[model samples]
Target chain A: MLIRKPADIPPSEITPRSTYVERRRFLGKLASVGGVGGVSGMSGMSGVGALAMAAMSWRPGDAVAEVGAGSLGALVKSAHSTNETPNSLHDISHYNNFYEFGVDKAAPAAQAHTLVTRPWTVRVEGLVKKPRQIAIEDILKLAPLEERIYRLRCVEGWSMVIPWVGFPLERLIRWAEPLSDAKFVEFVSLHDPKQMPGQLFPVLRWPYVEGLRLDEAMHPLALLAVGLYGDILPKQNGAPLRIVVPWKYGFKSGKSIVALRFVAQQPVTSWMRAAPSEYGFYSNVNPDVDHPRWSQARERRIGEFGKRKTLPFNGYGEQVAGLYAGMDLRKQF
Target chain B: MWAGRVAKPSAAWLARIKVALFLACLLPTVLLALGVYQDRLGPNPIEVVTRGTGEWTLRLLLITLTVTPLCRSSGWKWLMRMRRMLGLFAFYYALLHLGSYLWLDQFFDWGAIGRDILKRPFITVGVAAFMLLVPLAATSNQAMVRRLGGRRWLRLHRSVYLIAILAVTHFWWLVKRDITEPVVYASILAVLLGMRLPLHRWGQARTQAAAKGRARVTGPAWPRNP
Candidate 1:
């Protein structure tokens, strides 16, 4: 038998584990020493190109400061939090499916800079007793924010474990004081074409909309997110306000939301409007209920090489599965 | 006559052009390798590589289809010499695409991949397109051409039309929304297919005219020539 010594290995093939393990720390140090200009200079490139450049040059620590300035303050860790190591904030922010900014995964990060998250008001109307526009500042004070790490499953067979900072949607719904007739709650996103360039095209219905059953909306698991990674939300990740419905597909969590309407009828979401057969009203995450174009049984978790078995209700079935009770997930999916 | 009127490059010039074309075809793979080496493929390198290789496969297939039309329009008969190489490059990228899916995306989880190919329409069509290309790629050599004879080989190669359609449909069905890129490729494929209609008719008409001329010269064939 022939044995090769450690010294025989080429230096180029061996990257010290410590160098990669402390890569973010090294990048953070690099950022402090004039790496900010490189990130800013990448803005002129195409969306995916810019994201690639940002991924290479920008430090994850500085990304929070550059985008949100840590406006969210300290968050209490929730019992509902998953133990999984959440995807890097760079991955969560840079690779988004916020179609308001653009349809491409990287478009939101590149184009959402034009979005004005401030001076934002969410109109709480429809079946609510008091139909009025609430300022974002007032909404932030509704409940104590908590960090709940959850698995976000996209319909495209990709998944991400995100550490989201927000309070329950039940708090916001209770604050609104919905009438008894309110059976469903529809979330509507901002619709300014100038800010969200993708809205200029009719790829999806303008002013993207999503909805949930009254019981689903009242579920403690449903979160009204304002921030992520203990920082205020980046414009690309739906700044000001967004919903995080962990049990459902990621698209169900509407971003850059400007309105929350309590309605009696099941709202026709933008996805449902575009392709009724593919996207349904009750988009609960189910591995058994495969998407028409691809399988939902397995998913490629971002930053990971191989796929893992996608769980039913994204592995929150114990808590939220009761909401669907005896319904057919396949038909709904 | 028009083809003769055009200037043909010398053997050395043609060889250099072939070399350049081969390198040009290999550029995407080289860049992809550099991306992997530099760790510039973003958070999901497998997804990037898969998508990149798949896209290049479609692009090269479209470029391969364009060669015939270009030769017809420009009377550059030499262009056809590069078609098989372009087509094989497309096959190479397709192999890389499948390799990424099997090795990187699925990690050799044959059961999962089998289920996906069976259950998913996108995967089914993509795999079908790749499978169809296998025989075409296998027979791309001059030895196989001589073994099968030109007519049978040509007939077998015609399946490329079906492969192209399946490849486009694979892309079209995979997208969730915003079908702009797929639409653009589909339109190019449509134009290429449409161009073949007129060329096929022209070839048929020329063959019929030649047959008629031959018949006119060999009149009264029923009578004994001796």
Candidate 2:
């Protein structure tokens, strides 16, 4: 009998969110019973089975108070499972690599509370017909918000499944109406040293900036996320607004985004500028193209004990691979 | 009197001290093992194990480097006996550190491990530091020392300084941005290396001068030929 591969299984036949989450808890219980033997216990299941069973069980009833006032969690659509379990809320929020906050994985969670995201304004400029600094509130009203669960693969060889609430980046880009010459979309993050203590040290030329080619930015998979896990975004997790490029490394999805500029040339990203050899501008999640410092072939999912092989374009190849069609990913990476 | 007592520790006392030091050196590994057995290494236990082992290796390397200078400064010659054990412990921790990387991180994937050692600068320096320690550890025994002779053995062990430098560099290069830990280690190693330069020469010169004074006390009355 021919077994159907997970990728080949139609969305209609996929497991329900409730069943998927229940199976995950069951597996998690089984794993704990195996008593911390690393990934061996979790490895009993196939990688794809584990990925689909990895969703966090946060529902509408769990800590509604933590959702924060005026949160967009209510507006979030029901689960459209990305076929990958998201990192636990604790793991997703705690284990971050936001250099603007500090270098340690825990620093962002500790230090990002000081960030004032309420009065945030996102400036849209450079090669756009209309240059404006839209108020955070006004930007929220610009387009209808939608929930999307996307896989975030970090360049440091770790990954997370994040349930993001936002609208397509193309909506905002279209609203700005880019000039004919605009070939790239540059994202600039808030650079307040007072709010972000890590800015006191020159980790990377601050006001951390990242960029994407215009087509990549306009892709349907690209999201301008305002919240995660059906709640207001935590400051550490890039509160107010941030980019979510599911196919690229986590660093490429700049946090605490304050500006979006359409440029004629490729913009210098913070990581790419700091270490040109280690981080390329494109920085797509390609396992075959190893990082100069570590192999990108495998990534430790945030909550899992074992590492799983990294997928091409972070398992979104069908949705996003067409953008990089004839290009040498190894060279570009 | 206390200084004199420190200078001339009895054989039994030294033996007891050696055993205590050995157990003290083993404490981190013991606690780490307990943590593993009890499942208390937090969410990322492999990382905890890897980093803990790596840190112990670096700490032991620094401890090994301190032996000679400490012996010179305090005039406690017996302290030199602890050097071999300290060096061996450093190698033990280094082996555990590499084992964690090879077994836990790389899962004995030779191709991936080889690529990491070759491509990553930090890993390269780390591998270099570990390789340099192998010879020092191999010749640490009395029989090997006798075979190699004192002069050759001393020369071989001096590479520990280089290993310390490389080990510190490996750590410094591994971090993404905040380097407070590696910086502290670098500062300590720098001072240790510096203390050995003129102070070490002064120590040798004083020993030679004392030897000359002893020769004068025991020399023949008639100083015939010059």
Candidate 3:
């Protein structure tokens, strides 16, 4: 009966010396460039410039400018950013629930290297007025990438604060120009088993799909993330492109998206198809409404000990509460 | 009864093997301790520990159940000596699994734990399995066996089969998807439980044969008709 304590990471180890210095250097560079508004001047920048400014203000301690085949030019700090500290990049990348690589938490990091992110194109079709295939390169430059630190609450009773670099999904939806009749948006992940071994298994139907109400998709809080921690997203963390719906369960935010379909009807998501009784269409984070298998009232935040009381909508009630104001969360959940 | 007798190991050899088996049974806990000490349990150490202890509990329970059939088929009577120890070790791991949930996962929050045990079917079955193991573990000693008599003791201990089933069901219900691990455990348990059916029938046949033999020697209580 050896009672050893959980790993006690020192402050220095949490943010490595190199990362700390790099963050300081980036902040100093932002200050030296007087023409470009510094952190405070981000509000003054207009259109995509504001987003670029926000990207410039992004201070991932160990920010890497280049990711895979592309360079993430500048990331501005988003007004939507959560004040909570983001989990370490190691923990964030190493521990994931991306089933496309494998079901095990550690499986993605090990098996995701085989995935080919480049030469990727997302098809935006269905009820959209202007249906088109958007290449990954063009998607990255579609809008100024902002650093949005959001609380990602998984359906499995675990939570993490992630600094995601991407523009709002609204931007992409606008580009696609969905028809007025489009009620829901469906995201289709890559279905190539040759690239994603997990696809070989019929785990929730291949080409993992997720959906959102057109309004939820248009919410400013819903982001199409390209990178995390100011660096290009690792393959395991859904590299190339993924959606981030902060208020909903992490599974609602589809990863490594290959297509966006604007549909007139509510699309049957992968998880909903897998277990309709457990997962619902909305999948918003409601602490009161527990998952059928486990309690959702409390959640264990990554890198922290003990559980904390889970907040309704993961504490994003202020922003997204209106969307579900009259709806029955329990019924939807 | 199914196979020819195998050579029994020397007492000294048996003792050494028992010690090795004891250490082997304890290895999972040791590795988990090392993981904690070295901080290698990853970000979610509690989860790792919880799952590790629970998996070992199920495995040890299945291994303990294997001894009877293994000994019967292999003609290794010496293995029977290890069954109690193995069963006890299974209970030991069960205790650790429950301890981790209560102390680490719930932090002795009885209200939360109670709600989980009552509300969640998985936790309910898991707690039920552990509760049933308590009586078996208590009566595992020679004294309790002697006091209760072999027949009653055996009947009481038969509950282990139910406990094993409950443990597997608990695991089956808890997994979100990817039931491969639970399915494997359940299959092993199914095979172990299935093996007992023939042995039970054989025992029943033997008892009937013994009773007929006694009647033939002692004569029928009532005289035969002319």
Clashes of 2: 1
How many backbone clashes can be found in candidate 1?
Answer: 0
Given the true complex, what DockQ would model 3 score? 0.21
lDDT of each: 0.80, 0.79, 0.81
> In candidate 2, residue A90 scores what lDDT?
56
Local accuracy of candidate 2 as per-residue lDDT tens digits, B52-85: 9999999999988888778766868788888889
**DockQ list for all candidates:** 0.23, 0.25, 0.21
Give the per-residue lDDT of model 3 (tens digit) for A48-146.
Answer: 663455456555644443222234666676667765667667678889999989999999999999999989999999998877898998887788988
The per-prediction i-RMS, to one decimal, reads 9.5, 5.0, 15.6
Task: Identify the leading candidate in terms of TM-score.
Answer: 3
Badly placed stretches (over 4 Å) of model 1 are A1-69, B1-6, B213-226
Q: Tens digit of lDDT per residue, candidate 3, span B1-226? A: 2233234887887899999999999888778765553346776777897899999999999998898888777767788888889999999989989988887688899999999999999999999999999999998898898898867887888889999999999999999999999999999999999999988876667668778885333322211100
Per-residue lDDT, model 3, residue A186, is 96
